[model samples]
Target: MKNDFEDKMADIMLGEAVTALLDEDVAISWAALTDRLRSAIEIETDEDRIRAGLRAIEEVRREMHVRNGEKTEGKRVAALTEQKLH
Candidate 1:
């Protein structure tokens, strides 16, 4: 059984990322996550844990961009890879 704090942290992290993915708005997603991270201090979550959660949330956001075909960086990388392979 996870601590309630842990569950809430997970929810915030994933929820923010999922929302951002759906909206396809990176700026808004980052802003919301930053707000959630700041609020975590008020909720007594440790700094290390909050940082880890933030990193995970960022990863989720990036993955969402990739999956949604909104990753221009990924496309550039793919092109580079193809050029090298040829």
Candidate 2:
């Protein structure tokens, strides 16, 4: 029972770490993602899984970029501050 509990805890921690790492990879740097991908391919453990993860991250990034551009474009012709006459 103790061993099972410990295993579950480790799994949770590992999942959290991977999530954080993926966030960083998508937001700031892709080094973590690249390294993980290369390792996965080299080890031949689960290339399909690794590729899927990469594709998902890429799609999210693409959507974010598109949304950001739309937001900026929408604000381009809008006034930032209201003009008030005293």
How many clashes does each candidate structure show, in the order listed? 0, 0
TM-score of 2: 0.41
Each model's RMSD to truth, in Å? 7.1, 9.3
Q: Top lDDT: which candidate number?
A: 1
* lDDT score for residue 10 of model 2: 40
What does candidate 2's lDDT look like per residue over 1-86, in tens digits? 85465455444433543676767775534455445444444554554444444554454456668988999977764544332321
Indicate the residue-level lDDT of 7 in model 2.
50
Error of 1 at 26 (Å): 24
Which candidate achieves the best TM-score against the true structure? 2
What's the TM for model 1? 0.33
Taking all chains together, each candidate's TM-score versus the true structure is: 0.33, 0.41
Q: How would you encode candidate 1's per-residue C-alpha lDDT over 1-86 as one tens digit per residue? A: 45566656666666755575568654555556656544554564576467547655655577666776757778889999999999
Residue 3's lDDT in candidate 1: 54
